[model samples]
Target chain A: MTQRISKYQRLKMMNPILQFFRFIYLSIKILIVVAGGHGGTRNIKSSTSSS
Target chain B: MAKIVVLGAGISGHVAASHLRRKLPKEHQVMVVSPNSNYQWIPSNIWVGIGRMKSKQILFPLAPLYKKKHIGFKQAKAVTFHPEGDVTENKPYVLVEGVVGDSKGKQEKVTYDYLINATGPKLNFEATEGLIPGTNSTYSVCTYTHADHAWEGLSALIADMKKGKKAKILIGTGHAKATCQGAAFEYILNVEQELRRHKVRDMAEVTWISNEYQLGDFGMDGMLLSYGDMTMKSHEMVEMIFEDRDIKWILGAGVQKIENGIAHYENLDGEKKSETYDFAMLIPSFSGHGFKAFDKNNKDITDKLFKGFMIVDANYSPKPYEEWSVQDWPETYQNPSYKNIFAPGIAFAPPHSISKPRKSKNGTEIFPAPPRTGMPSGITAKLVADNIIDTIKSGKEQLHHKGSMGNMGAACIASAGFGMTSGSGVSITTYPIVPDYEKYPKTQGRQLGKTFGEIGLAGHWLKLALHYAFIYKAKMKPFWWLIPE
Candidate 1:
């Protein structure tokens, strides 16, 4: 048997109406994460330095 | 005036070079030596492979951009590292060979006050028997040119399928130790969707083959992610996506060899099997460039400079997988033996595989090597550049700027299909690329909400947005530094 996908999951994926909302929600979520700054270098603690 | 040399102009080297040039004065020269004249936004190659985007749209000539920014550009490949220089050259220099134009085959000793070895992994197609791209019905999407050929093969197959001919398509890792399952995963989905778009979906059977023990190990031990209101394993999410798309999967498969239209593989159970396909897109194993190094006395010091890829200030001691700590990962990406040398991105050797190493019953190793591309490459390169800039300005060595895969995060937007309204994407954001079990033991080494997963058209839009954004950043357009690495 193949992996199961509930009708709700399918509707959430293919339904344009729900996807539009998803698009907005994801945009905000991702923007927050990106703005929160998950990247870039941090100052190394003296103890962590190998030099 | 210090001369900083960056080898390879991929994400890592390009980022390092750009930052160094932007931060340092014109007197302090920033040079990039690479065989590839054009700088490619590699993530978009997935779109190009599926005929959604053209190769030119994803890459631009590095020479013009570098010249405009006052950065020295050389279309050459590094042959050997003379970090301690040679008899005649008292200063540290790298031996390079020209790859194009009238300077082809000419060798030159390019000296540097500081060196950044960002020469990413060499795609080792030879590691697997008969796995050459564009031959034996096999293809690759690791580069723009390779993606072009893959699209040609795929489009032809689509045409054949439209003519009432049945076709079998295979896409995944080509070798037992190949990584980048994420790219192969994205490609398969795009191809499946393309088949549907061509109205020949019923005429072809598409398969997902990989070296991963589970469906979504992704070389990071399969994340535990927050999806909507529920918490789920990455494997479950992948299985749902695959099943919903009617995609067949063969996991724990180590592809050993390829024939004209057949792939020979060994599964985790130690059984040998062959899968036949009309078209295949397989990711080859990634290996070091086999660059040799010499000291001032001309003595071979390859071990001091390289452990497969360039050796950085990371713990390389042999230890059990259980005892592997996040601190084992390197922060500064500086080579211990050569203080002036650094390696970021796939150029530096990882402390160990994020995924637990596994072996088949017959002792054939079958697990994904750690992936160190895209976000990690850019972040690591920027950190390395910042530290070098500090060193140069202070007139002393500095290792202050630091980021490690253990503490850094990566957002992977895997485009499932290509379209404004009809496309799909599976977006995964994992914090601390390497799981820190000690810090967050409850959620399998990563923070739950931060290490989340989402599937929808939104992810596609995000992926497309990043394609343009990164291209803009790479081109160093107005205020490009505003874009985060």
Candidate 2:
């Protein structure tokens, strides 16, 4: 429970692999919203993505 | 004419009774029975707890409203239900006693062709040890009085902090099997806001304790909603905001005990920890008052029923979480045994919990919550009413309520200021409250900007209107049904 990874500083200085995965995740999220619009997009995508 | 006896004159009961009047002709009797003659707008208890609103503003007497509608009204708490014909099979009715303070109530036996047990829930203020007055352990917001008491307690705590004391304020449930994380989340933030306003935030520390696997899981699998290229997971979003406000949290932890100002918690990793709080408000776990009286064929009626809510054609099986899906939910909310008896409100149990419960290998109790709100309760009442009326008209039971938690959206406006001001008020709506994780896998069950980002003066006005609008409709004024369910 001691401090290991604080989302604050590390997010700004991410390793290549971590940065790559983050980009992919953000891209997918953006695509889902564009496909569904704000109202139903995330909810609709959630059903398929399986949260 | 089939007489319908509606139990509990709260939101569900009153709504059921009022709709029963419109659906059932003048020939049929629609009777409402409950201990409180007043209908309390429950959600506002938060304001009442914080001294923002008086109890009278939230409470409206139910007797006179029912009388004006020509509906039968009696103020009494229903203690028991004897469904069988008994030894002689002479008169079939349930015998109920009276609440001590209700003057119009007495020991009576009432028979009904159909009974809607919207008997809401029994507030167990003593659910968690030490969460009661005179115990000096913690505080609660289960009822108007409980909220008021919580407010008074917090005020005293604030005063102590002003006296140059470093104080720790903890809010949230001690039980993993608790729901209503929304309220806990709101209270902690409001307390932080209050502290900052008082210019003594530096001297006060705030923390949240819940049974959720994560901060905003809310018994529904965590949801991630993206707003303008920034994706915020519900749990992550809440935690982030809390951190920004300098509030801390303990997640996936169950309360072991609460003694005086000390709280003992067991974390998800089975690590036990203790924390001392200067003031605390811990929401308790909720359950249907599980009471069952058996029938002749060696059958059980209790497991099949909760409070007075009966499990209908619901696909209720003790399924593990991995196999859970929206298809497993019931489409029609009709009781298989008694077609006439319908339930709406907290009394009716969810087919399963939104958040998964993690029990010990030895099968001891752990996390529990099936998040259903007053909106769903009101909608369920409307749907149940429709089905009953359809049954009456067709002379055959028809399943008209096809809506389930899996299919419905929940809109909640959590008040921050109880007034219009800059940086005050929040209106949030979640689509398909039980997330369809398989569909939008990333966010679990959340739809972003389903109006969460639209928070401000307009939101404040909406909250204010809803407060009065709901109260007006509940009072059974003219054109009530036109006001919407």
TM-score of chain A of each: 0.60, 0.43
Clashes (candidate 1):
0
Candidate 1 fnat reads 0.24
Tens-place lDDT per residue, model 2, B401-476, is: 4556666666666554444443244445566667766755655655555413222334444556667888988977
lDDT of residue B370 for candidate 1: 96
For all candidates in order, the CA lDDT equals 0.90, 0.66
Q: All candidates' TM-scores?
A: 0.96, 0.84
- The list of candidate 2 runs beyond 4 A from truth reads A1-51, B87-92, B101-106, B125-127, B226-229, B294-300, B304-309, B360-365, B437-458
Q: Quick one: best DockQ, which candidate?
A: 1
Off by over 4 Å in 1: A1-3, A6-8, A14-28, A31-51
Clashes of 2: 29
B-chain TM-score of model 2: 0.91
Docking class of 2: incorrect
Where's the lowest-lDDT run of ten residues in candidate 2 chain B?
Answer: B451-460
Tell me the tens digit of each residue's lDDT in model 1 across B18-110.
Answer: 999999988999999999999999999999999999999999999999999999999999999999898999999999999999999999999
